[model samples]
Target: MKQSTALTIATGVAAAAIGGLFFYARATRPPVINPDVPEPAKPVELARYLGKWFELARHENRFEKGLDGVTAEYALEDERIRITNSGCQSGPKGERSSASGRAIVVDEGTNAKLKVSFFGPFYVGDYWVLDHGDDYDWSIVGEPSGRYLWVLSREAKPAAAAVEALLQRVEALGYDRWALRITRQG
Candidate 1:
């Protein structure tokens, strides 16, 4: 009986030690942002960039939780860009929810960096196009802070190779690729 009790206690201690190590490793993981990296893409053409883009994958955020079939439509209005983002709450066939916003180019030379405001001027956020296809068929968007990310395409389902290439590009830009969640579109 004594030997059995000692073995049980030893097992419990070992389990606790393993659990603690796991937690520590997770907590000590490296951050996503790498300040040494350069700025986002340059010379984005506003004309070709306007239109609807389907969200293929993104880093989780509160505003888009439980949403699918997500898409963003951009329209050029004078010097600013008008934005309309929409998604389904349950799934691809679920109820639709949409929001309208505006984006102003911060750098006229590159037309890559922009400040977007969905809730008026007081709550603006960064909207930087980090990478995009030559034909404007796909784009990877993120912010200066590196907390948000989105992979969007002109089609509902782009080629797998295109998606994989985008993921690689995103990782090279210092974002956590593992945290990306694929979105369902229909």
Candidate 2:
């Protein structure tokens, strides 16, 4: 090819690369800290964190389909949050499945966020406490990417008003409410 033709092709490639980088940077950037995560005045006592927590709502995703009555049971095991999640399905009993994971607090003092590993070899995700009630009656949880969310409570179901309020809070954080799924409790 001629030198001018080669220069034009190289320029095109560089422009495309720069544009791609700009778009990705705009899309995936994390939220700037408005304020450091508040320290729990009295840390969440892990003993009460145990027991069945029904999935009152979640950010919509394809993986959890037909999994409405799901519950995540948390217990302290070896100083880690041992989690067992099980729920009904639209398939055979043999097809119904459960996942076990562990959560370890990333910061020792606040106990506000944790890293949970579900895959072997240990892939972890941020477990941010987006919102919580003083009585531990209801809580909103999400990850950094806004890819996962869960509305949890000790009761089998939460009031419609509570759900609406939680949705508003998440939306205020710039997450999408239209994509939220209200999971049916057992």
Candidate 3:
């Protein structure tokens, strides 16, 4: 009811919001680019690329922190691609959480570079397909900043040899060996 009390409360809320933003920004893209991320893969068949993909490993981030059994599903929605990313929180048996977004090809020629927005027009994220299997069995994705990396496979539990090969390719691209956090598929 007092003016001074209201002022103090407002100030506290503002400070909390600012601090939250600071941490969120930090958890976002890496502060400095280390390994130079390459361009997107060419001749990506958008149609074939559609379907369910299990997340094998990734560069940990706040958004996906505490998540397990991660998976991304893609489907054609008119001219845009609908993306649904789902995972269990805390642990493999924990509650599930999902985020849906839409993606558009930034480079129509290659169909590898995509800008996806989960919060409508508020926020957008870039992801490029660095490489993939000939039959689209596995894929390596990253952004230009080299801060984020995602290794996905067509199967929930892919063969060890297949995953090792992909990991090798990822390391050859300059990504740090310890940066990847292998997901616990449920």
Candidate 1 lDDT over 99-170, as tens digits, reads 999999998898998999999987898898888899999998987656678999999988888888888988
Residue-by-residue lDDT tens digits, candidate 3, 76-144: 998999999999987778899899999999998889999999988978999799898899999999888
Judging by lDDT against the true structure, name the best candidate.
Answer: 3
Best by TM-score: 3
The C-alpha lDDT values of all candidates are 0.87, 0.72, 0.87
TM-score for each predicted model, relative to the true structure: 0.79, 0.69, 0.85
What local lDDT does model 1 show for residue 65? 84
Tell me the lDDT of candidate 3: 0.87
Clashing pairs in 1: none
Where does model 2 exceed 4 Å of error? 1-43, 91-96
Arrange candidates by lDDT, highest first: which order? Answer: 3, 1, 2
Better of 2 and 3 by lDDT: 3
